[model samples]
Target: MRHLKYFCILFVITIVFISGCGNSAKTSKQHEGKIQITTTIGMIKDIVNEVGGEHVAVVGLMKSGVDPHLYKASQGDIQKLEKANIIFYNGLHLEGKMIDIFKKMAKKKTTIAVSKDISEDQLRGWDDGTEGHDPHIWFNVKHWITATKTVRDELIKYDPDHKEDYQTNADAYIKKLEELDQYAEDKIASIPEQTRVLVTAHDAFGYFGDRYGIEVMGLQGISTASEYGSKDVSELRDFLVANKIKAVFMESSVPKKAINAVVEGAKKKGHNVKIGGELFSDAMGEEGTPEGTYIGMVRHNVDTIVDALK
Candidate 1:
């Protein structure tokens, strides 16, 4: 009876050990099959999802309307970076202070700088003579379409088994972008030539204005950390009064104080200029909205500019 009792105890222990081993194996397999990806901005996350479809799990580091230039990755973000199989960033110092961290990750992970693929000639520099390329390529639907293709190609290189699906999805998204580009052209054309001047708090709109032929002016330089001096406000007020500019624009990521300064300055000079509308400058709209996606964001920007300027 004692021997039989001892045998039963060993059998139960063996079963428990085997069960635990099985569960661990299952968890390991799940982790191995899962592909983790991180993108610098919400717009890039949208593009990656469009190409990756159901194959990838993506995380966007920057919140909507958060200035990428001033963004600092938290401890959670660092963990995400360590686990990510692939990473994507806008590059061109868009993530201003975060550039060094991204460069370090590029050495270890499959990091892709989406905007780096754009030609240098197409890029515009910040007003301070800093040649750091403008990182807002999504403003131009054609340029975004090209960047999406580059993203698709990079994703496929990492996950070749889903190449066909990625290519198909990217092609469809590109067609949608082309349609968006046409719509932008039509909408922007409705605005009178003189009203096409876009003045904002910072120099973020150079790419958009250059793409659509609107003249862009900003009270501050590209970096939001830079202070807007009285001279900057005075000069802008002069330009507004001289050109009879009807509207000045504010950015979602920037404080309204700078824009208010422009308005007050213009008012002091006897110019009646209205604040055009809130433009999605450095970042996009809230998640789950139409402006959340890259195409939707640009379309909203075009509509906002036309509605105000026209």
Candidate 2:
């Protein structure tokens, strides 16, 4: 019986070891001859897919409706980062929680920040005397164009053999981005200047407002991690009532309760404020949807804001 028990243990150990090896081999084969890219957000993932084209396999750690400000990397994410040939992220403390992990990965892998190329002159400062520029650079289509070029340059540097393909793809993508930028500018201009105020749950649209010629207000600060109280709500409520702001937008990644509170506060004060629509702030829409892609999301936001505000 003792011999039988020992034999059974050995058999199980052998089976487990063989299975583990097989899985590892399969994982390795999955990225064979392809640049395995792990990106922090869907925006960066879209840029990689556009620039890398058929040569790279890209995976995004944060999907649609994910708030990157508060996102923490999991053990699975760590493994994904480990397996990646290159990693792309939005720096400027956008992925605040994962900054340390990114530093560790930079020592071993090609970890690139797409926002690194954007100059400080183009970035917006916080209104609350806080340090750090706003990290939601994609809201401004022109700023996103800069990010696209950064991805293109990095991919070409890493995979020089595919430099021509990367450059061609980037040219096509930038053309589309330029068109999107024009569309946003035109649509925003149609709204009356006073009625062009964009109020949302958070201050994610400072860059958007600056680029598109609209005023922006938020109940919370730049990062959703910041807290807001009744005093903040009352102040915003008073402003909305005073300005007669027609709509307050909600972010897909942020909770609706805060905006709802603002809207309700306005109603109590005899100013009717509507929840304009949910905008893709920190994240994009679902995959395969029109808003899933970066250009699509921008168009959707422009149309939605125009329809509601104008």
Candidate 3:
């Protein structure tokens, strides 16, 4: 169904491009006054908005609670991508299903993976794909600052007229991220060392855990596509029970069935566990809320975890 959806959308986009209805060059030329950017996820979009300010108009292809791992582009989304001046995405197969489309776009436009600038040593080990770095680089504020700098550079190249604006915005955003990084460190530090474990629906927070000094376990693997079988649930249940873990989290973009199953399995073993509040894993919150933004989302997750465990 996912493949079929994207295939149909691509076919429609191909017709639009052939018809010159939404040709990238023509649209870009028309919008020369403002750089039109298209991004895959909300986090990338938020960074673009901060850096680009009034100079760029960013259209995010993915919305709140949408799982990039399983997202398929729609006909409208393809049209938006077709008309974009530059496209930014969280590569490293984070958008696992959109690799071919991104490759196709790179031939004609400034299609970029913002996370590409970070060194491999800074990234956690990822077993899937040819790229070994974990794609959740945004979870680490420092890595995210590197990606934001890349975004600023791309914007400057495309629209040098607003170079100062982009630079100022990037610098300010990075400053805030630095503060956020420290806040996470201090908050996680305040939690008792034995209780600083985070168990979630998936391994999306490996980078988060590594950066903030928390131990993380996911019932599912790095990719949501990975299997979560009886053994996996049983082992996590045993670990949680033996250690008396206070909370297990569910991700906004992922179903809660697996986490619930873990809870059930723990119950069968005579231990009661409660669901920690939903964390914004693969996506942010809704558009209007504080949690919708990058900093707010991180703070919300950290506060929730700290309060629950402490």
Candidate 4:
């Protein structure tokens, strides 16, 4: 009887140990199945969600309205990148400061620069007179659709198990982006030709202006990190006065003081130029807001520009 009791106790112990081991194995498999994805900006994260569906856990390094040109990644961001199965970023120096770290990660992980597929000829002018593409390709809905496709293809390459789902989601998203492009074109057409001039704190909207036939003037160059000079202000003020432009715009990521200076200088020249609206240049709106999504961001900008310019 004593021996039987001792054997029963050992059997129970063995069963508990096996059960714990099984549970641990199950948890490990669950963690392994989870595909961790990291994106440079919130916009790319949004696209990744569209293609990845429920299969991925996605994180964005830069928050909404954060200037990518001057972004400094935190230690947590590096950890996220290291654990990520796949990483995506808007290339063409959009994340100018984060470029070095991203390049290093590319050596180990599946790092994809989505905007690398954009053609050189389609890009806008450079200070050096070369085809330096604007990194804000998200502004143009058509270009973004192309980017979405690129993202889908890359995601499919990494995760072939969900290729059909990725393709389906990408196609649906592209249709929505197409509708957004048409909406932008219609709204921008309502603005008179002369008033279509978009002057802002920086030249981030070069792609936007080119796409919609609007002329853009900026106090600073493509990079918001670059300092704005008095000469830039003087030249912009003269242009506003000479053109009789009624509105100048401010960017969400750029400091308002520079734009305010333009407004003040224009007023001194007897030109009544008002701030058109806060445009989403370098970044989109807050995460939960309507302007957070790429389509919503472009819509909000077009609506703002049309209301101010028309």
Candidate that would win on TM-score: 2
Q: Which of 2 and 4 is the better model by TM-score?
A: 2
Per-residue lDDT over 161-188 for candidate 1, one digit per residue giving the tens place of the 0 to 100 score: 8899999999999888888888987888
lDDT of 1 at 236: 89
Candidates in order have lDDT scores of: 0.85, 0.93, 0.90, 0.86
List the candidate 4 regions with Cα displacement exceeding 4 Å: 1-32, 128-132
**Top candidate when judged by lDDT against the true structure:** 2
Better of 1 and 3 by lDDT: 3
Model 2 weakest lDDT span, ten residues long: 124-133
How well does each candidate superpose onto the true structure, as a TM-score? 0.88, 0.91, 0.88, 0.88
| True-structure lDDT of candidate 1 | 0.85
Which stretches in model 2 have alpha-carbon errors above 4 Å?
A: 1-30
lDDT of 2 by residue, 125-164 (tens): 8666877888989999899999999999998899999999
Error of 1 at 277 (Å): 1.3
Clashes within 3 Å, all models in order: 0, 0, 0, 0
Q: Report the error of model 3 at residue 233, Å.
A: 0.5
lDDT of 4 by residue, 95-167 (tens): 8888899889999999999887888777665553555556878777777888899989998888888899999
